[model samples]
Target chain A: MSYEDEINQDILNSKKLPEKLEISVLRYFWQSNPLIGKKTDSIPRFLRKIDVLSNFSENELRILAKYLHLRKFQPGEVIFKQGELGVGFYLLYNGYADIIVENTEGTDEVKPSSKHILTLEKSDYFGELALLQEISIRNASAVSRQGCELLGLFKPDLEELINHYPVIAAKLLQSISLIVANRLFSLTREVQELKYKLSSYEKDQDASN
Target chain B: MPQISINTKRERFKLIFFISTLLLAFIGLAAMPRVSIPLLLGYVIFLIVYPAVPTLEKLGINRVGSIWIVFSALIFFSIYPFVKVVPTVTAEIENVQYFLPKIEKYVTKKYEELRIEVREKTSFEIGDKYFFQALDWIRKTSTNILLNIPKILASLLEWIFFIPLIIFFLLKDGKKFKRGILKLTPNSIFERFYFLSHQFNKKLGDYIFAKFVEASIVGITITSGLLILNVRFALLFGLIAAITNIIPYVGPVIGFIPGLLFSLAEYGPGTTLGAVIMLFVVANAIDIAIVFPILVSKVVDLHPLTVVVSVILGSQWLGMVGMIISIPFAAALKLIAQEVYKEIYQE
Candidate 1:
């Protein structure tokens, strides 16, 4: 297997965390948990390492963890499929998931692989477009390339969180803008490559004639 | 380049979309100030019905009874408070007269002292006529406001009496009301409207609940704190703070000014100064550090800058009531625009 494939497998095969630690790990995102006086020390550091919850205050990070449902996906588990009603934004807490976009021609334009598409590891996030717009389905599918730990934020919960915490909205906006910019840059590069390929093909045809 | 043209066209389209949304939002915001009694009643009634639906169902209340119970409760609770508070708050203006002579004397004394100090340092004359003229303008404005109370009260009572009946009818037929409106729309647009309606309801409901909870908590907290501090009029000041706290940023300041003035009046300047400083710090700290951040995180997610800007713009158009409705109204409009743009344009 390729090095990338090995990395994906390692993520999928990673051991589940201790049950006691699991709640704290989840607390890293949902800040509402401590309202009734549950305290955890380790969660904030863990959430800070994750890109999405990094901007949350120590208190807010705890609240965010309360709303998150952490789940494990084994290799090849379909996390979500294209055209599914968008509900939650996801984060790769551990392991790798492959993002696959299906084109109109029934072909998958894979970002990294023809079979599985792009593999993402820890700290990577997706499905943000779902949070912003209603009636819009997921544009792509995320299938676990290896065993993966993922965090999810359902639509209603996110809106509630945003309404309550303006700072979180600011952070999410920054993350979203970064994601959009990255996508635009990649698309520009692809277009440039396509143009280069078309020009070379034209030159080759002239020589052959 | 082909890419440049596509980018430019896309940019132009985005600009158009953004401008149209802003215009729609402004129109919606402007409508809020003029929401009239019936619509305001409808909004409050709609809110109570959602949470009460399950409870009412469990109690074997049908939709009509639920509507009656909700509307009746709203009238008893809301209108009763307004009736109780408006006359009392208006009567409290009579107390303003008791303080006015003291205030004028205080102002004159302060101005005389300042004038003496200024003359000792520099020859800048503040004319006596100019001071009296300014004082006269203040008295005129105050008297006008005082005189307008009865006229305002009459209109308010008329609106209040009609609101509950309107609320009852709306609650009785809300789902039907919604469906009937949608049925008027073209088939192609129904799905979008349906989605938009759901999104609006969800966001608006969440925002209102979060805000109500936050305001209640803040009010109780400040009231308890004031009681502990032995502040006079603790109940009234705390109540005002809690109600105005609904308006974001400016609410606490408005709450503090009256509290500070009373503190100054009761205690000498030094004690008043300390109390004012302490109140300002504690009240603002609790609001910004704890209440607002947590409340906002749960409800609308608008940027703080956006919230402040919206509040200022909203207040400019709608006055006090407009300011109260501004945040959620802005959020609801944004949700609608997002739903529309995505469903209509993208697809």
Candidate 2:
């Protein structure tokens, strides 16, 4: 058989490339017809699943993806701690994260200071306030619940993105702001419902007495 | 056990192949300077003008138009000042060289006398050996640079003739090339490759841009300041200050020496003192107050000691260009190390 045919046969036999054919074949494939206008196809499959990036088009994402960084963490790793200055935001690509708020009401020693307030699975993002505010002090802590991968977007990169791709930058900032607003509105509604229940409970007690 | 062994073997294979590929490419480039030098120069120019391309696209300009506009503006600004300044700089450089002997003599005499006086009275001997050693180093560096000028000029001319086309192609195809590389990355470390390269590009590119801005500010301010003071060789001093300002710790010292020497020899200690005070104020104040705060703040979070060491090693190994690039390379390495370490140890 010819070399090409032999290579094909080898590929078919084990579904694993022969050692010599492997390196050469991959090289040949990689070097083949590199071109212009390569789109955001390289936006990692993991990042594409994130809610914040979900709304972005492939082209738009390609631009934003250029500014992001990737990081990995093990189970029990503290991503950020409460009261610490938040420098950037993270999109959890895989695994689980726990958003923890520490109770500051008790004495410094002897009291439970930390509790898991929220569980953030894949696509959930946090620390976004760092993007919008001049100073961002973390209200809660984030700890990896498992071996996790994350895509990080920082303040400096945002600034650069604004300068370099203003339209994309504007749309992204708008999306982030909308997410924050929705969260706030939900929290406000919950507070109002709790207040109404408390008042009704007081009236009930008065009537019974 | 079998799976782990297989994964390890595959990784080792990938490592060998990747390293070999890099080595081959580097060797090929070194082996063929004529083709490679122009490509290298073009890549550099492409990097410098790349950010503007995206901005122009956002502003609704086409690729060709964007490239033209950016390059035209750069060439114009660069060439105009270069034409006007070159003549004056060359003349002043001649004058500086003529006065070098006197400057050396004065410095040596003063240094020796001070050393003797200290040894005689204080029972402690001051060493002048290091001073001469440094002077020798400087002399060797300048002479080597001067010697290489003609060869450099020839290569630059070749690059200038070929660079525009190379840059055009790079701008057109760079994204595709990056995507191709990214697409080839395995899922296991795809994120690692993607983020590390982005960080490298951002930090290194920003650092370079900041240096250019710092140099320009230093140059223009010195030129205007000296002209106002009616000092001789104002343009030359300004140019010198600008070039050396890019060098970190030793740069300001190098920039100040010639101006002080000239002023002391020609005008007297009164003017020399003024010159000294001016250099101190301008170099420190402008660098600290304006340049760092505005153009360069936190671009590369390298310690000062890292910078000094990088410069020394770079100069020793690769001379002028190496010295300029050393800091950025060091910063890039630091960034990769931090990320990789976090990945490894955090587990």
**Which candidate gets the maximum DockQ versus the true structure?**
2
> Mind giving the per-residue lDDT tens digits that candidate 2 earns over A113-193?
566677888788888897888868789877777567777776766876887778778878987887899889999999999
**TM-score of candidate 2 versus the correct structure, residues matched by position:** 0.59
Error of 2 at B76 (Å): 2.0
TM-score of each: 0.55, 0.59
Model 1, TM vs. native: 0.55
Off by over 4 Å in 1: A1-209, B1-38, B78-87, B123-136, B221-236, B337-347
What is the lDDT, from 0 to 100, of the residue B163 in candidate 1? 62
lDDT of 1 by residue, B43-149 (tens): 75577456675466446666567667766676678867686866666666666666656666776777799988898889887678989899888768867877887
lDDT values, one for every candidate? 0.67, 0.73
Best by lDDT: 2
Expressed as tens digits, the lDDT of each residue in B217-297 for candidate 2 is: 888888778887888898888888888887878887778777777777666679555865576576668797877777776
Predicted complexes: DockQ each: 0.02, 0.07
Task: Score candidate 1 by DockQ.
Answer: 0.02
Q: Give lDDT: candidate 2, residue B292.
A: 78
**Residue pairs in candidate 2 whose N, alpha carbon or C atoms collide under 3 angstroms:** none
